[model samples]
Target chain A: MGREDKAMVKKAEAATGADNRPFLFRRHDAGTIREAYRKMLLIRAFEEGAENAYMRGLVHGTMHLSIGQEASAVGVGLALRDDDQITSTHRGHGHSIAKGAEVKRMFAEFFGKETGYCRGRGGSMHIADVSKGNLGANGIVGGGIPIAVGAALSARRLGNGKVVVCFFGDGANNEGAFHEALNMAAIWKLPVVFVCENNGYGMSTSQARATASATIAERAGAYAMPGRTIDGNDLSAVAEATEDAVSRARNGEGPSLIELKTYRWRGHSKSDRNRYRTKEEIDHWMTENDPVKRIEADLVAFGILDEAGLDAVRASVAEEIEAGIAFAKESPSPDPADLERFVYTEGA
Target chain B: MDQPVRELSYAEAIREAMAIALERDERVVVMGEDIGVYGGAFQVTGDLIERFGPDRIIDTPISELGGAGIAVGAAVTGLRPIFEFQFSDFATLAMEQIVNQAAKMRFMLGGSVSVPVVMRFPAGSGTGAAAQHSQSLEAWFGHVPGLKVVQPTTPEDAKGLLLAALEDPDPVMIFEHKLLYKTRGPVPEGAYTTPIGKAEIRRKGRDVTVVATGVMVSRALEAANELAAEGIEVEVIDLRTVRPIDTPAIVESVIRTHRLCIVHEAVKTLGIGAEISARIAESEAFDYLDAPIVRLGGAETPIPYNPDLEKAAVPQVPGIVAALRDLATGRR
Candidate 1:
């Protein structure tokens, strides 16, 4: 291993202390910890596969890859039930995987096949699996924020014990929808958690340049809600923050805002030239603050899994991703004649 | 024995429809600005909060975009939300939610979901409320593919169509003329639905077909009465729904009359008239046209504050009479 990698591992071990129990180990059993690891690995592998497919000209259009933000997605997902809802953003493959979506259907959607989540109509920007409580991944900035508020309103009115988690990027924090949705959710005391994955940049416009507030979470105070900012690379921090927010929502105590300070390892989209940021900055985040390595380090320090066990997890995730891609490649293309079928409800 | 139908104003008819919907379904909710204790800006939702309470008849803050989006989300999640825009002109502020979200949600989700949202707009220009408040922009919503746009002219239709919109599995935009609120008509008691996309023939004549929508339907009828005295009988067809327009009814009317005159309160250029005219020209009715189709609509300007100018901006009864007379005669 490289000296820098070894130093990061030693630092992670030192943070665990003599008892050697990470924050995740304190809250969850070994099984849940392993599952979280699998989900995060699955997200990374799925996006890597999607990236490869895009490079090979197998996928059309562009996609926003959430490569280094797996911990935030899987961490938030670990705190909620299967029935609890989420409204995702454009960089939503990780969120989808963490929320229990079948990778094959997601791949089929990316491939524009008939068996896809949106029947190949929505493609990557609008993947939705409502049955599993993913309302949708919106193309418009801050589009899904109000929708999540509405879903929470329905949950409150119906007396259903469901909480909605809304996921967005640092860019969406500036949108009027974000403020309006947060204000309404607060006044109505709706059950919702707003998770902002602040990956530093919004399509090359850094949050420092775009946002007025020092921290995105501080804006939540204006809406009369609790807000917190934490290191997103730490999976335990994300899980703990989400658990608190979800508990408050489920208890009818209203919404909370959590700012996950992380970084993206890829460009915003396929067409993005690396002109906005320097290579040294990207390399710093990739090597020092990688979410996958942090989790692996925590697991290893706590003795949840040995090196061979970690390799086994990686191999299994790789196999699942390959299988999902193959299923997408073999899926049938939708008939052109049925283009207008889902435009409106039948017999309405 | 048939139950006696009682006379009710357009506003009362709309309120009765909401009351019935709330009573029948637990999922139905009514939300808008000043719609609770204040009873709406136009007083259309009078005393509804007392009966249904604040939870069902929600009074939202002055956030059109946010309120509209919340309604879309609520509808997608299984709540039947009836969202009211204070004025039809306010829809411009919430177009993103209406066009991109509510209209496209089902298609984007591959039909796994449906947004059963009903938005009511108090439309048209008779009131002194100038440019912003007075607009008959039903044509705008009609132009959209996924939306069902309807203009209910009478008290009976106002109640019936509102009920029908609640039952629809997709978003329905109802443009209610503000001036028609006080107009009374026979409205049947209890739950009843008027079929959307069906134009009703108010008065059938053999001379010329007068196609009109919203408040213009009543004006067309008045013009028909005035023209009948001069031996120029005019047929008045109330185009209740604009989108998914009753093309068959219009084609049949044009075929019988051999002449057509389209009237609307919106601006004439690229308005609903243009769409109707193009449809007739493409259909079998085109062969039967004796005179070129005449269109009488609003002037190409924002509604003015002056009472006379406001009246002159849109097609009044006198304007409809003159247009129909021109079409019936050889004059262009």
Candidate 2:
């Protein structure tokens, strides 16, 4: 509304160019770096448990596991302030955990427990804890992208000084809403970050088969915003890229599109046969680009802790998971009469 | 208060209503394509952007998906965002946002939220806008579960219906006919709210009940006047709200009159008349019926580019009168 902000809005559109350049990373504290690692491990463990529970019919819906992709969720989430919001994908348990949503309640939701994030209303793909600023994962492919842009626009309108990060897949980039939302964000210079998790495939369709372009991040130039492709498997690289983008957004520099180069190690969903991907494809990421292992290696290289100390954190996290399971087991299913609740976030 | 009962244009009535709403509630915000300084393509929101400023009167980008979604978001987040679609046809772009997200969010979230959003769509045919811009798709939202549909006939009803829509806790789709903007009548001087999902009998008679929606109400009344000259008395009902439809009113009128004719600008198949006729046939009103319901609606075709072709596509006053003549004389 101010003259200064209006001038910057004009300059923001003119800032975008045809240049394809690399964005470098900055160093972070050892504690912050390790926290990202433990969080990824926790996400992996929780989802692994969910996959097993779902197979046993303990959980009802199809589970979209973030088994292979964690660093992107953790790195970007760590860069966001407490008030900053994020919209995630079906493969979003990691995003939720990374954004500081309660793990016990998330597990409870999967188990149809009364103590779940949505009180058992939303299962695996719809875990939303708005109080923690996680806008919840969407069922549709590109559904939540526009919502994130809208949220950022609201922040900008009220001058709330809060940024919104929207997380979607490479498949979503093909959606009209994606382009429209990104263009609106760019035109308004709203504080929004568009994160494209290019995990090789969109459901059963490979990105190569579905997309005309070679790289998804390159398409961001059409929307006239800064775009980057990072080593999504490398925790340090993702963390650094996220910091730069988050800082730019906070400074009223509009939105940034980041393509995190990673792959889904498990099947796309619980029922996925994963025949579209070769075994070699899965093995290479498992052996070389494992995020937890990368961080564990750094933890030892810095002489901060030995294997025993790290083992204790894992054990403690596992204990918390067991208690969550117990809580989920005790949690009751929602009554049929309570069906008409919480559709809107207001006075429902 | 005794105000002059002069005829007013539909667009001017909408503008006057918006002025009153802005005067009534500070929480109300108007957002849509060209609704800002552009004053809207139809000029329904004339000069509102200048008077209310950007915060209250927003000029959103040409992204209907984002515009409607944000309006829904703002509505749920404690702001009453009255969205305007430049043309009713553009609603197809925001169907998922309106039907799936805004409409069902209340029920899906277990009644924990209230989508107090009013979507003002410049609907129906008259501008020769061709297929893309000229459409009357009210039946689409009316069929949805968690939404309310309103279509006003007179200027006073337009004011009343919009005020009521702004106050509802659910999403209300207000279908404004493109040709009805200039039709004027007695509008109250001060603040008031019309009861939604309620019908008003514009005229009382005995021979037949002619229930119409939106612009067809005026057309039906005209047909009734000509029919009165032919010694066939007809009652006209204006169904203000399409969803949670004023069925009891229509059934009551039909039971007394023993004949019914439903009229609308939309196509005959799956139109509001189809549903209302089915309701009449299934309900207790079936026992009192003297004739099978006659439904006069638009022909099945895209609104053509040629003005003549376009005019032939939808219902006209002559068409309404012909339908009424057939119903009174036992002709098909």
The weakest ten consecutive residues by lDDT in model 1 chain A span A1-10
Best by DockQ: 1
Give lDDT tens digits, candidate 1, residues B49-159. 999999999988888888999999999998999999999999998888899999898998788899999999999998999999998889999888789999999999999
Q: Best by lDDT, which number?
A: 1
Q: CAPRI verdict on model 1? A: high
Clashing pairs in 1: none
Off by over 4 Å in 2: A1-35, A112-114, A303-305, A338-348, B1-8, B20-28, B54-56, B76-79, B109-114, B306-308, B325-332
Cα deviation at A151, candidate 2, in Å, is 1.0
Superposed on all Cα atoms, the candidates' RMSDs to the truth, in angstroms, are 2.6, 7.9
Output the lDDT of residue A248, model 1: 99
lDDT of 2 by residue, A126-188 (tens): 787676777768777777777787677667666778888899998898887787788878887
Clashes of 2: 20
iRMSD per prediction, in order: 0.7, 3.2
List model 2 lDDT by residue over B1-114, tens digit each. Answer: 455444567677778778888877876889888887778988888899888898789888888987887787666545677999999999999998898678875554334456
lDDT of 1 by residue, A1-348 (tens): 343564565677688764334468888999999999999999999999999999999999999999999999999999999999999999999999999998999999999998999989898999999999999999988889989999999999999899999999999999888888899999999999999999999999999899999999999989999999988989999999999999999999999999999989999999999899999999999998899998997787666888998999999999999999999999999999998988899989
Compared to the true structure, candidate 2 yields what TM-score?
0.88
